[model samples]
Target: MDTVYSVVGLGKLGASMAAAIASRGFRVIGVDINRRAVEAVNAGQAPVQETGLEELIAANQKRLRATLDHHEAVLNSDVTFVVVPTPSDERGAFSLQYAAWAFRKIGYALKEKKGYHLVVLTSTVLPGSTRYGLLPILEKESGKRCGVDFGLCYSPEFIALGSVIRDFLNPDFTLIGEYDEKSGSLLESTYARILENNAPCYRMSFENAELAKIAVNTFVTMKITFANMLADLCERIPGGNIDAVTQALGADQRIGPKYLKGSLGYGGPCFPRDNIALSFFARAVDTAAELAETTDRINRALPAKIVEQLKPFFHKGATVAVLGLAYKPFSHVVEESQGIYLAKTLADIGFRVVGYDPLAAEPARIELRDQAVVLDSLEECLNQAEVVIIATPDPVFRRLTLADLQDRNVETVVDCWRILEKELKGHSIRYITIGQNINDEESQARLIKLWGNTDANSDT
Candidate 1:
């Protein structure tokens, strides 16, 4: 049998990594503390939904299997990828317990094994954490000098939730922060086919790689904050559309368009936590990131602003339809998502909220069971809703027409992504949206009267 590479967690990222490595003609054994998670992968069932995960799992089933025993997985493999979870604490510090727990166990497993193996830390950690926390433990437990008896490196995984399989097989770039070139070469060889495509390879020291992940997220968060600021300004102007302004701005060569559209501030398992963690890391060095701190405040306040707008629309005991509940477009993940926070706030304020998402319905239901009613069909949820709030811009939701919403009891539509703007116009239905003009005749008149017409055209 050929030597195998082991993935020490069977979550979405870990499972996808195992399947991807196995598909490349290598043996892969997945390990997870959750027996059910392990069993699902071994039986060709993916624990999480992704674009092409099932096919990948089936194609590599023979070469891939799962187990709960870390020792067995470690002893049987030549290379190990530690892709465990590293969530944030209540005070926003990066909690290392989960990553530390897995690393400590891996260290014990390495103690009993005899071979020159490579272990790559694929989880996000604060700068200098791997060198300070993980390296010393592994060296202590194994009673062997690192880089001599074994090799270690940090090659962080950067996969989007719904498109993980594709991201893994064809990454935009690969960041390898190795202790030495020889160790990096071994890790790079494992991804030789991937590297052959000429994707950018970033070679750096361990701390820089850690900060790079945080820096990327911080930059994206800043972009989102800037977009949201424009959205707020656009709402105040009479005829200004923030989306249109930003679209034009994006056309400029200097500002090439991507994360420029304003919507609910970023939230998922990654961005918010990473942003806060980066800020905390900066504070430790007696240097504070004022911009990152501002971005986080802006993001947190966005959901509240959404709730405030909906409050005036709600009559006593009114029902509201919340569309697309996931944090982002297609993923089922709701961690730190604005949609979930909005649902909770709406429900607490006495509005009955019904949420619908293409893939996130079930997960959202479990996550928000006490906060709102998660529905399977959009049509049913909108039946008696006084307001329809499209929280997520799921491509499927964009296909909805005014006719479909006409049959519902919806008196107003809140378009978070500026979606269905033309369709809502044709129906002449009262609609309110972030980053766009209000369509309700009465609301428009009131806004004009209160604010007075200043420059409606602010696209210069």
Candidate 2:
């Protein structure tokens, strides 16, 4: 714990990492090019929005500080973690533009410092990015041999935006892509002392670790898409329930039941892009990645497809309310959200859309502009709607009762996650769930005809 840590790029992940590290009895220096971020962190406040981030930063004030100078941070710390953005390019590959710049600055700082310092890249990137794209920049700017003078590592954090601090302190495992044995050992030991969970460490070469990081994300998305595909199939079958099917699938030892909700398509800043990036990476090295490509295609088309299916339920120019506009529950981020996509698609089809989220109303309003009305309160959104679509499985929507929904003016409710099935099933309002049959008798007759059954009592 005596070794000071410096976290570069004070965005959501970086800022949370700095605060979380400091909370565990280590001095942390936060580095960012943004003056506001630096000033905010230095004043014991969080620069970006995240769950419990402001309070965590405020609590760890004594051990944490921020600086704009990379030289100051690197010279004073034993290990510097670079968490700059590697945004997706037009080719769907993670662009190393920001990461390269950060490495160059850290490399320059290494030239002036005399001891062994470990530089860890905690940003997500494609395979060979750390070794090929970023490693040379570090060696060139420092004018030094990598393992001999200093050590380097590519150690991306597997975390989501909302629960970053909690996820960081208690990760299932830590990945270390080492320049040499010395570097990996240092990072592993650092995790041992700092992490609250005492997680296992996976150590390997830079390329393998980089590929593994992206592979984990892409694979999870594939699993999620498979569940969604089943959801689509379930809608056609008589009395098919996605929850029952997924529960059985989850009991299987291989599947293990996470991200198998089978309601909405996977969407977020990371999930939507990682699959495309992995597909792009696979094709670059003479490999076919149809699963990833297909997953991306299916997930992208899900919003519009759902909208089209609900077209019959919607009346022309009917006021519609979309509850939960954020990507997932308990976060303000609207980037690549299915809720936002649903709002736009619904509005484009002539529905007067009003959207609401506990935290994401402002950003959703900005993204939606004139397409939908982003309301200040959920009550206001519900009060103005003739029809409602539950886009996210937020807990507030889950708590809605039959009386809360049945004003006699609201005609229909489409529950995407079946959150209101028990409360509104036998009510005056027409209730529909996304992954279940609306007309069971009609579906049974269609299935009977397909099997050439002449009698209604005959079994296929």
Candidate 3:
């Protein structure tokens, strides 16, 4: 009498979604091509490394199970959610090869099953992909008419890697792209039961939903770029503070402060590629996505810009330690990580670069092999460094005291997030905060030069 769920592809997002659904007292069947992933799920363990994922899976073992057989999953479950990776191709578009394969298998399973089944695509793809690219495969394989014998929906999740479980269960809102009214209503009802927060659902055509997903990510990147631009301007102006400026800007109802932090450029699995894909889509449609293009260019140039800023402090053959190889704090994912990019960029420029992360050391090591030495411990990295750059504001890095830098004989410390300003300032080391004016005298001189000084007593 209840809707049973089957999630295809047991990656980070898929496994977490499956576990979260089952935790809410629903039966879930997970399908994956990887034998190890399936085995891990069946053994009441997490297939991928994510925060709180293993515990969630172990607690809901009775309701959640995984299998290699797609047929078994589709036949048993009422709805199947395809969460496969739609990796970006060389052309800057998401290649739906994996999604197509998974859809074909599900379509074959639907052919044998003699009941109404719903198929939902949770993978990120370009607009016109779900309906034009993937839907035909389903109709052909299943030999069934859509909206009659079966249903299809495009429903991608808005989640980050480290906090997938929490974000999935309590999204601000859900986007549902439906083939027909029947399929949309069914999914809306299912989400109503699963979501912890009474999140609003936005239902529309498949193409609109696909465009909306990428549009949301690109818009966030634009905001992040705007904040970074502000940080650059703050560094140039005397007594300019990014926090003060953004705080007031955020006070306005139109520009609420989310992702408005003037920190490092965004880099993860999603933001970078999504922006590029939107640009590519724009070009295809004979429209100019100059803003998206410029945002990406700025974000990509951030590492080089930081390197240029630190070049003055770098001495010949000096060891420079980079803290936080992951893109963000408390994450192991190094995909397009700005920290890793900084380390590699410095290494290429002949600075003896050493990198460290709390959890992403191993992956960063593989990424920066022979370019920079990826150290295991934070103390080890700090010990052999003449200059240290705090790339991400990790909690461990925040707890750094005077003892850490004073003992290391470090000459310069660049705090990208400005987290160590209070503790590190006025110390022996030259502390530089990215968004704050380092030299007031120099900035004041430039300001006076730009506009002829008019003293208070001498009015023009």
Sort order, lDDT high to low: 3, 2, 1
- Regions more than 4 Å wrong, model 1: 1-3, 194-196, 310-316, 439-460
Error of 1 at 277 (Å): 0.8
lDDT of 3 by residue, 165-199 (tens): 99999999999999999999999999999999999
Q: Scored by CA lDDT, what does every candidate get?
A: 0.83, 0.92, 0.94
List the RMSD of every prediction in angstroms: 4.0, 2.1, 1.6
lDDT of 3: 0.94
- For model 2 the local lDDT of residue 408 reads 39
lDDT minimum window of 10 residues, candidate 3: 451-460
Q: Across residues 95-180, which tens digit of lDDT does each residue of candidate 1 receive?
A: 77877778778888888889788899998888988889889888887887888888898998777888887787777788888988
Candidate 1 global Cα RMSD: 4.0
Error of 1 at 324 (Å): 1.4
- What does candidate 2's lDDT look like per residue over 130-249, in tens digits? 888999999999998889988999999999878999999999999999999999999999999999997999999999999899889989999988999898888888998888899999
Clashes of 2: 0
User: Which sequence of candidate numbers ranks them by TM-score, best first?
Assistant: 3, 2, 1
Top candidate on TM-score is: 3
2 or 3, greater by lDDT:
3
